[model samples]
Target: MDSLRAAIVDGRNTAADDDQFIERLAQLQHEHGPMVCRSIFQTLAGIDLPRDTAEDYWRQVLYRRQQLSRILGRNVDLMTAMCDFLRSETRYLPHPRLVEVDSFERIVYESMYDGLTGLFNRLYFDEAFAHQISLAKRYNTDLSVLFLDVDDFKTINDTHGHIVGDVALKKIGAIIKKTKRDSDLAARYGGEEFVLLMPHTESINAFILADRIRQEVEKEEFTAHDLTYRLTVSGGLASCPLNATEPADLLHMADSATYMAKGSGKNTICLFKKDKRRYLRVKLMQPVLIKEMGFNDSQAYEGKSKNIGIGGILFENDTPLPVGAHVQVSITGRNNAPLLLIGTIVRIESFGPNSYDIGMAFSFKEMEKIATAEIAQFLKEGA
Candidate 1:
């Protein structure tokens, strides 16, 4: 009730649209109109407003004004009548100090919350992130940030339409809201991207939560326009005073971890691990197409990427390509764009009865570009 009153006062001071406030007012009148009318009528008409009749009268004025007019066989502005009654009886006036505070609060609310999801916006995130960092630094507390991206979100938008895309985003928001604690801060970082700031939390705890969110989203089906679609998200989590000491570095680390998660698979969560390897290998669960360079081998072999790094990749092959044999590796990017790399078969190990683990070392300069700074950072941290 206090919050409701504050919101109403804020709305009035900020010159916000009055429909929401008016509706709230109507509901309040409907619920407790008898005692309210009795107090007001005594002040104005010097008489009691009958309980039984006043309840119905206020209900009609609040919720059934149009129907009441028809029933009474007369058109009347019930809102004005109610307000006039208040004006004559109650000294209904907005306090100047309260209005000033209300206006400030409205401004803050608009700036902090996302217009669509009702989650905190990015602007507020920057402040919160810095504040959390300060608290962690001062008190030696743990802090973690999870950076998540919806898998194949572009495909959802392309196939189901933008409206359905919006539905998916909103559902994800609701899931996060339901899954997270009040202490955690959730923000829509951008389109198809979200950031969860968990203060005084460990990286493993962050990963567990991220995985839970991923699994729940995967299990839930989004229905729109009679089309049902299941979606998944990949997340990367980085901890403060562990992986990073600064805000930008922390965000970068989390984002990098998220990128690795996406590259490895679309529905998994990964923790920031700064591997010492020259090339950071990410587990790729999807199939990769491999072909011998210059069409030397006309047949293209199908293989699943076990892991991918800047300089090399480990993959499964039934008939292992000979060491030193050069081949072209093609995989799908996040946008469904094709990525091609040239590498030499570096190592092969027997895995199963018919399958072999093939390690290929990339030789292309473009391969270097593909291994991002986040991956390098992870490697360096381990180093």
Candidate 2:
């Protein structure tokens, strides 16, 4: 109640918009109950009234104020009525000292947001991340974190000067904001890095969003000093309950995965590998056909499966595929029938002069049960 009074007094003194003042009153009433409106009405009316009567009068006042606002095409002042009532009752007038509501709001906004990129700063992200972790723990929901770093950021600064580098960072920040979901929280995690907190999301979904942001950044062009250049970012995703429930551990996993993405040649997204032993991996050197998801059969290339697992497969290919690229894999099943599976390339490493080892995680949500069952059988036979 005292806080409500202080807010009202502050609003009144600042010559705040009447509509904003009314909104504050409405918010206070929502938080503290009808007692807020009742107190305001009783005090202004200068009469001791029952709770119901005071609340009823307050409601009527609100309705009339709305009608007058519509008729006047502007906010109708409730202060006028309060002053009139006090004068008619020969009561003492309420006086509020001068306070700057605009300045206070600005201060609060600046504290939480970065002035350069307009994204949440590190301090705000830390506080919000802790709160989200608590909520996810309480609800047993999934939470994913995406860590991204600009590829060759120092090179951009050194080659084009700090002003151009700042422009590139700002452009990347805008791209992230445009690509991410409204519920996701994006923050500048200091110096060429950003973090995204996605509540109630799994690693795969987080990967999709992160990759989209990466692609957007790659495609965007930044111009400063009459020179235009493009930027790319590498991202890593880790989820709670799937990776680690501990916040620090999950964040570290994401950061480490980002480093892996950078090591794998940047501009890609990597999912944190929780454990290699989670699924039974069978050593099976078999010929498999591979192609990007939307490509034609003629465009499909042949790769040999070095190992197979219920969750994923490790294959050796002549050409290296980008991490996070969706691909279709066709492997010969035990029945001699070809088993086609859709999966995402998660890891890639050069094996030889013309060969690369590619790790693919299966998209179980899109795969049929029979396909997974067949893979299980193959793993069992090869185990």
Candidate 3:
């Protein structure tokens, strides 16, 4: 305590020093796990430590690392940090372990497809790009990529905030999601920009979809902070087999077309003119929902949420919910009073056992601000 306070008072080390510490801590990971971390902290504190207290402290750190692992969706960095800590003491580091190709393949497949939009991701650009190359090598089918970006998205986030930004994204996502048919692939490449893969598509067809998406985004009004704003997107379309056989050539072509659109101005679509290079983006926002909850560990709590736009929620094995059953919902602090709301399962998706997601429309009134705010706060508090 005295050393920590002195360190803080003297500005010796801030709490965020975990970065450099993490590197040193990585070396001790193998021998003591999180205990090595706790021991190091105790050594720094220079206090006589109780065995039980040290154990508890280490346990808490372990829990926090595990929780972070879940959020980051990867254990590599933290695991590597611990292993490095071990190496410092022994002058030896753990050898690299080989990963199975099958595992890599599976993750790559998942990476290619966007879970939210059901389209492919930026990674799939390579997939489709390569596929096009193969086809061009053999048959002569043309493939095209339309790199579309939402314009002035920062303004949306600046004006309405991220919550509203989320709404815009979902709205735009819905629009793009519906715009593409069975043959087209769409993905939220990063923030505001989306990539579309059109197989066996002509530049004309890709432009048609691009124009439709732009117009739809422009016409649609996203409401945030009790204000409505029009949205629009800029597009750059580049075709393969016609423009270039190489993937880089296709990217360069599309990048050029996207640039021309941006250079000319806002809310317009432009296909790559063989050598142009530019990119302007479409503007959009979307909502973020808190997927997990932390209760006081009382009795089982109910989880209820209604889709603002979609039909009823799914009730199937995919969501881990049983068939024909209604769920209990607790919107954290707001549901301090039991909700008058009820939802019955009407439909289910095909995913089974892992858990079934339910398709349910609220039998009661729309949830009030308190519920939503509480949920938003819960997520913000890092709970």
Candidate 4:
């Protein structure tokens, strides 16, 4: 309940958006609303808020659901979180001190894009490009653009349909996102085409990245509608400082390169520069789950952590495990005992599938002395 209240305090989740919360929650469990509610109530009790206050909060949410049901003339599932929160004692609490309203609005707006594919609707790309160009000119950094077209898109679209095309786009977008560092942005230009804006990345990097994206596309296979299709992408690579002095000119140069790549051949990656880095990076996130005992009544039995990093932990799912149950995980990867952390699932996220993703503050003072750092380094370096 404290985290729930804190999230409300943060202004991202609200009792007002009860319906949306229910929808997102349902993604995790279809028929476990009651079980979910009980777990949530139990978890709420462990928080800083008084038990009576928390129960009152829950009661108010139920009352609100009843009132809403009367107004809307329908039965509201009182067990689900949003409905419960509507009746929660904290529902009427003072608003949070968040100052950045526009940031939330921007995040809501960005969620519309295919994050895996990096495609903006035709509408968003224009504005974003303009914004980047403006920033580049203000900062006096070199700005370059690369427009890419996947070769044989129609043939793939015809043979495997739009699903395969989408898969290809997503895979290619991920490749570019991994290829470029934090300074660069790539957007789905449209269809099987993508546009990249490189801030301060020289023409050499732009051309190399374009070629890499193309080669990356060329190497992947798309499976859709039960058929696998070998897919390749063609790119037109252009840049600033060499081909053009302005953003507009750079965009034009890159677009013409796309035209040239298609003209030259369908399955090749063309570059605006002859020299560039040729290494390809493939990224994959690891999932971690928890161990269940022979006898226990814990709400969640397992968790998952995504992308464990150098200095900290990466938790994706959560669960509650009592001592003696033992935390058991099953990951199919290159063989190794990944990381040896000393802490257990202390706190967890209760949102989805009744699974907890706990945050672990490492207790090992010297992980290398304990071989924890060795395992972490091995997985990171072995990769």
Candidate 5:
């Protein structure tokens, strides 16, 4: 019981010995999961070990690790590592087999990490997203997720070959690891796509971080054989309890924002803002016949639908419609049946003479009478 206290107490052991103990503890925790204070602590108090004493002992260990981390380098995020270990261990129901299962650390690592980039895999990311969202909701803290995708990655693969593409992905992964805070999580959401979970972070900070990563990606040069190429990334930022209240909603919003950045032109960062009137617009190409309602006795006008959302539709029309005009739009559904929707003109843009783009917000008050669900689902799926 006196060994650990004697080893760490003032003038009892050399600094080198202290370093070795801390390193060993970290390694042991990694291989066999978290260690209880009884396993690491040797006290000189000669008092009985209280059931509540482990937490205080753990705090001491973490305090020492914090100091060691500063001395060792920025490569380690002690608090983050500690949090991960604690979170993992606490989730396990106490059992001898459960402990043995946790000890199979290599299997867990392989399952949770992406084989290609060594970042958190999609499965692990889903778990993290849920965990972070729950914490954010319970504590009312700011949490943001960043969705990033390499710009024109398919072109890179086609031009340089898949080998070159692999190299680029690995390089980008390294950059993400280097750039992100230790407390933040980097995950490979899918092919050429990455997501970051930033705990206790605001949208502005997340945007700045995303921009920094975008700039870094843009400036990075990759060499494959005799050819050198540069790449860029597009990013989207969405915050919890702000842009969305659920994990799926948050992810969708971030993805929608990323799509928006791609649409605006790549190599940019976009922040997701919940639209008061619109959910998300999905690009669709369909011919529509529009008739002006109320006070208009004119002929029906033809327009091409650009995008459709639950809240509105953007379409190109040769005839300019007044912003306040009420109209009826008829379009063919996926089932080849004509679907009708009533909307109010909300926006208009002219690209050339006799060519105008119009935006209309559907009046949802009467949408129940129409089969809009099937049409919306088709558009959303296509989008």
Candidate 6:
């Protein structure tokens, strides 16, 4: 204690010596604990610690030291910083014996999270979305939005009662929390609808996450009235700078895509694809062999094309494929010659008990000219 007072009064130590002294002081404080240091400060300087908690007191001490160093144009010791803080007009010194009963933190948590889902509520989500959009724009980073809706949610409520529906929603919320990244923000937007905001993520990656949640929801079983049933969800994905930069526009795009997913039949994930060319979609019902890119030939599925266009193809298959899967579609071109088109499965909808309608968006990066020419020719001939 005397050595510390002498060192502070001398005040002739070099910068290196001061740093070493501060390090040793921190080591002593860590070893002996903050209460001992607080007692020492009170006995030596005759002033209370500036904050209620020991951690807060130490934090304020370091923060005030930085401020004093900047103002005085030189490094200052802990005692000097503490004395300056005690003399400051804006110091936050609370009564040591006063215990706070009403925790502001608990109130804030109640306001931010939903009562049932335990996820962020709509109000908090809106605020967080706006803040994240600002950060993404400032940092030139990517932001993705996922909009999801429960399929046949009203039916669940009407049939099994609202209690079952609520349980299903809670389960879905748990699935989302498990599937999404820690950095992602998820919120219950309203009844049976949820939204997720992903920072520094692309649209494709966001689609993968949304699809995983969809699969999990589909696999989850809900029980009520001595019966058990399954549920599914449809989702839509959009990204910043790729779809729209404005928050409202991006959300609208994702919602529109979600509506498209619902219209395409349900239990699907659709990416917001802006139709740049307004390609003519023609009805072309023909048998096509569908093969997932990363799978073997034995796993190939057969489906019939319902519509063909320059941008994409819609087909019905007995098997369902996940969204964001690369696929090769083989169809009979002019003169019955085999024409293979490389594409991606962007949407999947349950058509019947054993049938699914798959939407494949063409990827021209592999065979641009050939696939374009074949699709153009096929559409012209069909027309």
For 130-246, candidate 2 gives per-residue lDDT tens digits of 767876888888899999999999999998899998888888889889999989989999999999999998666677678778878888878999997888899888988788888
lDDT of 6 by residue, 1-383 (tens): 22222222233233356567556556655653554355445433445553245446656767898988899999887666765665563344333232232553345456668889999888878867876787688888889999999998999899878998898899899899999999998999999999999999866557778888888888888776687999989988888977888889999999999998999999988888778456678999999998876433448788899998876899999988878777789999999999888876767889679889998876354346345655786688789
Off by over 4 Å in 5: 1-103, 276-383
Lowest-sum lDDT 10-residue window in model 5? 1-10
lDDT at 259, model 6: 94
- Candidate 4 lDDT tens digits, 1-383: 12222223233345456566544434322432223333344332222334555445555565677786887788775443333453344543234233365765456446335554755544455555665566566676666787877777888778667777788778778777787767666778777788877777654445555656666667777666677767677767665555666656667767776777778866654545333332222333666544442223534334455644322343555434432222334444567656444332223445577554554322233222334544665678679
Q: lDDT at 270 for candidate 4?
A: 54
Please, what is the whole-model Cα lDDT of each candidate in the order they appear?
0.71, 0.77, 0.56, 0.54, 0.72, 0.76
Q: List the residue pairs that clash in candidate 5.
A: none
Candidate ranking under lDDT, highest first, comes to: 2, 6, 5, 1, 3, 4
Model 1 Cα lDDT, one tens digit per residue, 1-383: 22223234454455434455456555545653445444333322233457665555455445454654577786545444455443443444222112344565666577668877878888778867886787799888889999989999999998778899999999999898888988888999999999999998765456557767777888998998989878899999998887898999999999999999989966877777776575466888788998875343357989888888765788897887866565778888888999877766656789788899987766444245334543576677789
What is the alpha-carbon lDDT of model 2 when measured against the actual structure? 0.77
Residue pairs with clashing backbones, model 1: 274-378, 274-382, 275-378, 275-379
Model 5 RMSD in angstroms: 16.6
TM-score of each: 0.48, 0.59, 0.42, 0.42, 0.48, 0.56
lDDT of 6 at 112: 68
Query: lDDT of candidate 1 vs native?
Result: 0.71
The residue ranges of model 4 lying beyond 4 angstroms of the native Cα positions read 1-107, 110-112, 115-119, 271-383
Better of 5 and 6 by lDDT: 6
Best by TM-score: 2
Shift in Å, residue 103, candidate 1: 6.1
Model 6 C-alpha RMSD vs. true structure (Å) is 13.8
Error of 5 at 93 (Å): 14
Q: lDDT tens string, model 3, 1-383?
A: 22122222222133245545454445444533444444444333223445565555444544556666687796534334434343333323345344554664455447456655555566655655565566556776767788787788899899778888877877888898887776676778777778777887756456666777887888897886787888888888887766777877777777677768888887887766543232222221221122222343424433334332221332222234433343344332333443233343334445445544444433232233234655787788886
lDDT of 5 by residue, 43-81 (tens): 212123443565465665467566657887853544344
